[model samples]
Target: MDRIDTSVAHPARRYNYWLGGKDNFAADRASADAIAAAWPSAPVAARENRRFLGRAVRFLAAEAGVRQFLDIGTGLPTAGNTHEVAQAIAPSARVVYVDNDPMVMVHARALLTSAPEGATAYLEADLRDPGHILAHPDLRATLDLTRPVGLMLVAVLHFVHGEGAALPIVRQLLDALPPGSYLVASNATKDFLPPQIAAVYDRMLTAGQTDIWPRTRSEFGALFDGLDLVEPGVVAAHEWRPDEPDPSLTPADVSVYAAAGRVP
Candidate 1:
C-alpha cells in the first residue's frame, strides 16, 4: 500500500464526499461543496449513479446471466458496490475493480470484500492504459478472458478529454473480451441542460484537479459500436431501468447517460 496525499482534491475522493462518505478529506469536501454550489444536482446525480450501478449489476447477473465483471474507474468503495450487487444475485460472480487513485485503492482494499462463493480483486491501474488492465496479473488470475465478462466504465471516461477522447481506449478494452461479453457505461452529458450549468462544470473541471467532457447522446452511444444495445438504448442514468421510485430522481437531476450492450 502507499501513503495517500490529503493535499489535493481528487475526483474520486470528491465524488465520495458528494455521496456522503467519510473517506474523503477537507480539500475534497471543499471542492465538492464548491461544485455543488454551482450545480446543486451534483450530489443527487452521484446517488443516482450509484443506484444505476446496483440496478445494472443485478440485471447483468440475474437476467443477462453474466458472472464476470471488469469495473474500470471504480471509485472509493461505498455501500452497494459492483461485486456486492452482482454476487448477491449470483454468488459465483467474479469481479476485478480497476482504478489509479491511491486513495480509492486504499479504501477499496478495506471495504470491497468478496463473498465466499465469489471472488474480488483490485488493480492499481489507469483507464488510459487498457492494455495494462487486460494484462494485469491480478485481473488475469481472477477473471476468465474466454467467458462473457461485464465491462463497466461508468462515469469515468470524460476525463479523457479531446476529439478522439477515450474511444480508442474503450476499443482496446472491449477488444480483449470474448464474444457475448457486455459493455456497460455511463458518462456526463450536456444534453437537456442549461448552457450555463455546462459552462460552470467545464470551468470547474478545467481547474486541473479533474478531467471533464460533456458528450451528446450520440457520442456516448458510439462507445458501444459493434455491440448489441440492450433495451431503452442510451438514455438518462436514472431512467435506464430504475428499480425504486426515487421521488428525488429526475431526468435533468443527473447529467450522465447510461447504457449496457452485449458484444456480438
Candidate 2:
C-alpha cells in the first residue's frame, strides 16, 4: 500500500465526505464543504449517484444475467456496493473492483468479501490504463473474459481532464467484454447546473485538490455509441428506474446522468 496523503483532498475521500462517511481527512471535508456550500445539492447528488449504482447492479445481476462484474473507480466501500448487490441476487456472482487510490486500496478488504458461493477481488489500477486493468492477475483470476461481464464505469470517467480521453477508455474496456455484456455508467454533468455552481467547481480544480470534467448530455450519450441502451435511456441519475417518487429531487438537483447499455 502507498502512503496515505492527508495534506491534499483526494476525489474518493472528498466523495466519501459528501456521502457522510467518517473515513476522510480534514482537507477532504474542507473541499466537500466548499462544494456543498456553492452547490447545495452536492450531497443529494452524491447519494443519488450511489442509488443509481445499486439500481443498475440489481438490474444487471437479476435481469441481465451477468454473473461477472468489473467495477472500475470503486470508491470507499459504502452501502449497496457492487459485489453486495450482485451477490445478493445471485450468490455465485463474481465481482472485481478497481481503483488507484491508496486509501481505497487500504479499505479493499471491505469490498473483497463475497458470498460463500461467490468470489470477489480488488485491483489497485487506474482506469486510464485499460490494458493494465485488463491484464491484472486478480481480474483474470476472478472473472472469465470469454463470458459476459458488467463493466461498470459509474462516477469515475469525468475525472479524465481532456476532451476525447474518456470515450476511448470506455471503448477499450467494452471491446474486451463479450457480446452479451453490459456497460453501467453514471457521470457528472454541468448541463443542468447553475453557472455559479460550475464556477465554484472550477475553483476546486484550480486549487489542485481534485479535478473533474463534467460533460454535456450528448457527450455522455456518445460513450455508449455501439451498444444498445436500456429503456428510459440516458437520463438524469434519479430518473432511471426510480424505486419510488421523491418530489424533492428535480432534474437539476440530480446533476449526474446515468445509463445502462448492452453489447449486441
Candidate 3:
C-alpha cells in the first residue's frame, strides 16, 4: 500500500477522527478538533451520517429486497459498512465499493470484509468518470447492471464543486441500473450551520483536500428527479427514520444532509 500523506487533513481521515478512530494523523485530528470546537455537534453529525448509511442499507436489503450495491466514494471503512448491513439482512447480497482515494481502496479490502454467502469487491475509480466505474473489471465482475442495484453516494457528493454537476453523473450511474434500484446518499450542507463554521469549512476545501457545496432541501432533492423518494423526504441524517427513538439523535445543526430514493 502507498504511504498516506499526513501533512494535510483529508475529509475521510477527519471523518474517521470524528468517529473516534485511530486511522487519522495529527493534521486530521487538529482539523477535526477545530471544526468540532466551532460546531460542538460535529462529531454527533458524523456518527449520524454513519448511522444513516446503516439504516439506508438495511432498509434497501430487507424492505426493498435489494441484494446488489454499488457504493461510490466509500470512505475509510468503519463499523456497519454497506455489505455488512445488507448481508446481515440477506446473506447473498453482493457489493462493489468505488473510490479514487488510495487509502480507501487499501482499507476496503483490509477492513470491509464480506460474509461468506455474500461478496464484496472494490473499484479504484472516481465519481467524475461514471463510464470508468461501469467498465471497471471489479465492478463488472461483482455487480450485474441488469439487476436492481443500490447506488450509494453517501457523504462524498459534497466534494463535487460547481453547479453540483455530480447530479448528472449520478443520473448516468442510475440510468444503467435496472428498475426498483435505489440511490442512497448524504452530502454536506451549510444551510443550517453558523457562518464561522461554513467559513472554516470553505477554507479547508480551498486547502485542496475536498470541496463542499451545500444545497438547500429542494436543491438536494433535485438530484433524485426521476426517482421516488423514500418516506420522510430529504432531511437531516438523524431525522431519516431512526430505528430507535434517539433523543440525542436530534436533527444535526452541522452542514450535512442525507436521504434515500428508489427508481420506479
| lDDT on C-alpha atoms for all candidate structures | 0.86, 0.88, 0.83
By lDDT, the best candidate is 2
Provide TM-scores for the models.
0.94, 0.95, 0.91
Q: Put down candidate 2 lDDT per residue, 100-138, tens digits, no spaces.
A: 888897797754689999999888899999999999898
Task: Give the clash count for model 3.
Answer: 1
**Ranking under TM-score, best-scoring first?**
2, 1, 3
Q: Which stretches of candidate 2 lie over 4 Å from their true place?
A: 203-210
- The backbone clash count of each candidate, in order, is 0, 0, 1
Candidate 3's TM-score: 0.91
Candidate 3: residue 111 lDDT (0-100): 84
Per-residue alpha-carbon lDDT of model 3 for 1-264, expressed as tens digits? Answer: 546787878778888988988888898888888767756777877888898999999899989999999998888888898898999999999999988777888888888888899899998888889999998888888988898999999888876776657778888888888899999988777678667766776776667534446667776788988889999888888888888766755454545678888999
Which RMSD does model 2 reach against the true structure? 1.5
Model 3 lDDT, residue 125, Cα: 81
Index of the highest-TM-score prediction: 2
